[model samples]
Target: MTGIKMAAAVCVALFLIMPTIAIKNHDVTEELSDVPFISAADAAHMQEYVAFDTREKDAYQKEHVQDALSVPPAECSECLFDALDIYREMNILVYGADDAATADAVELLLKNGFERVWG
Candidate 1:
């Protein structure tokens, strides 16, 4: 599967991310550019969370997780509270073009009072 597709599957599985993930037959675990998605059996759990595509605006317009809001790195600033305070206690899922970026975005969200954030 493609890297992004594999990542999406991971997103779904995490919420029961699927099994072993590989991109174009390459095991990308060590070289992954994005956060590693985990596993959870309850898909319903996602209902209590919000998902954000933390890439640039153009990138997010081109592609993003279904139902996820587009919150570019710059947009993730303190202004988030204007709309996210009501959901501060909710779980969050942040994905970016790469792993490091995703981690940073997740951390930012957490610091801003998001209780839980998953890859």
Candidate 2:
């Protein structure tokens, strides 16, 4: 009886929590869908774009797109906002070591009212 009750309680908790988790995850995906991914060639064709670098300081210093401003990672929200706030009106091209890193930076930029952002 005790084991059955425990199993039932666990099932009930998961049933309630799973939908909430799924909804939250889905919303995050939907929110990011609006931010487009531009190829390096496409970005180069643009007359002007603010290159936003989400790579580590060392990686950025070693090699990055010309004129890319090092904004580091999205974990530092305040730093990203402070560095990028002035360029809100400009088109931004974000690049990082991986897709996940770039997406996180792009998401942060979009949430902060940066309308023209690409990864």
Q: Which of the numbered candidates is closest to the native, going by highest lDDT?
A: 2
Instruction: Give lDDT: candidate 2, residue 64.
Output: 59
lDDT of each residue in 9-114, candidate 1, tens digit only: 5366333222332223244354343433433333233445667777899977876666678878787656666676776776676667755576677677766767
Candidate 1, which segments miss by more than 4 Å at Cα? 1-47
Backbone collisions counted per model: 6, 0
Per-residue lDDT of candidate 2, residues 5-112 (tens digit): 433433343233222222123444654455566654344456556767788998778865545688887445777588667898888877677656767888878888
CA lDDT, candidate 2, residue 6 = 37
**lDDT (C-alpha, whole model) for all candidates:** 0.58, 0.62
Query: What lDDT is reached at residue 84 by model 1?
Result: 68
Model 2 per-residue lDDT at 23: 16
